[model samples]
Each structure stands twice: as structure tokens, then as C-alpha cells.
Target: MKIAVPVVDDSLRMAGNAGHTPYFAIFNLNGGMFKTFALEGLRANPKVVVGEDHHDHDEHHTCDHDEGDVEHIKAHDTMAGTIEDCDYLVVKMACKNTAKSMSNVGVKLQKYNGIETSASKVLSELASQFK
Candidate 1:
């Protein structure tokens, strides 16, 4: 199994928001062993400009199609694509819509408390869960 985690940098520090992270640390589980690899972050198509990076923007919308809305959806979709090969996505927090959209694409969402700061530690904990 493979787990995708949003990271702040090459060090693999967990990023609070998946869409805004600079990289994603993908952990591969084989024979109960895990290996870490990184992928460049996902960005929204340049055609859409989002003024602010808001994690809750999807929660406050009211049937309106604003520029940010388009960008938000596109960004999340791109994020989903980045980890589409993985079996799970682990994040500290993600907007409700983003999580739902990810679930639709067959990537299960695993929300971890911020207490664990490193991707390696988080992957260890997740590994224990599966065992």
C-alpha cells in the first residue's frame, strides 16, 4: 500500500493544508516496510487566480461560482491527481469538500492530529494501524 502525505519541504514536515504544500511525501509499504519518496506539489491551472489560500473556502460557499471557487476546485482536483496512485492521503486537516472529492476518486482520507510533526512518524503510526 502507498500513503501520500502533504509536506512543507524536502524534510517531510507535515503541511497543514494539502493544496498549499510545496511537496508530498509518498510512503510505500511493502512486506510491512515503508520507504519515503517526495513529489512536487500540485498547483492550480494558471488560468484561475485565487487571491487567498483559504482551507475553509469550500465550507462557506452558497451556490455561487466565483473565481476563487473555480480555482479551489481545480486546485483540489490537481492535488487529487498528484496522489491518485496512492491508496490513502493523510493530512492534518483538509476542507470538507476536498476530502469528499478525494474520496470520490478512491483515495481514502486519513486525518491525523497535529501532535505528530514528521512524515516518518506519521507513516509509522499509520503502519501500525494496518498491522
Candidate 2:
């Protein structure tokens, strides 16, 4: 089985929040051996938008899309894609939306409070649970 853990850095320290984590440490467990890799590209914050003053020129903003017309990009989208073959996701905490999105993709969620713990240690403990 495989497990995915959200991490803040390449060292595999757990992130404070799951959805906001920038990277995921994926562990592929085979018998007693495991291989790990880091997946990046997830953003913890939204892009900042700068507003322009209309007094300087004639400015017009128009949109043809409604609220439902736009597809919201949830954290799970990227996470799910990264760990698509994984069986479970272990994280410190996950928001409702993120949890729901992960569930929709057929990935189970495991809650862990070991944010300061190393990924190798966490994976070892998780593997023990199955035995």
C-alpha cells in the first residue's frame, strides 16, 4: 500500500495544515521496504491581485461567468493528482472541503498530530498499525 503525507520541506517534516501544504511526501510501501518521493506545486496561499485606479483612464471589467460557471480549484485537486495511486493520505489536519475532495477521489484520510515527526518515523508507525 502507499501513503501520502503533506510536508513543508524536503526533509519530510509534516506541515501544520494539509490543504495548505506546498509539497507531499509519498511513500510506496512494499513488504518491509519503502520508497519515498516529494511532489511539489501546491500553493498554501492565493495569488495576490492588485487593483488599478479608474481615474487615470477609462477602465472596464466584464465577466461572462457566474459563480457556478467557474470551477473552483481545491487543494485536494493537486493533492489527489499527486497521490493518485496511493491508498491513504496522512496529514496533521484537513479542512472539510479538502477532506471531501480527497474522499471523492477514493482516497482515505488519516489524521495524525505528529507535525514535528520525521516522515520515516511516521511511516514506520503507520505501517505497524497494519501489522
Query: What C-alpha lDDT values do all the predictions have?
Result: 0.64, 0.58
Q: Report the number of the highest-lDDT candidate.
A: 1
Clash pairs (backbone) in predicted model 1? none
Give the least accurate 10-residue stretch of model 2, judged by summed lDDT. Answer: 53-62
Which residue pairs of candidate 2 clash? none
Prediction 1 global C-alpha lDDT: 0.64
Cα lDDT of model 1 by residue, 1-131, tens digit: 77778766567777776545556677776663554334434333222243545342222333234446876677667767767777888877666655756886888888776488788788767665543
Model 1: residue 86 alpha-carbon error in angstroms: 0.5
Where is model 2 more than 4 Å wrong at Cα?
32-75
Tens digits of lDDT, candidate 2, 10-109: 7777765666566667766666454433343332322111132212111122223333532444434655665666678886666665676687787788
- What is candidate 1's CA lDDT for residue 58? 24
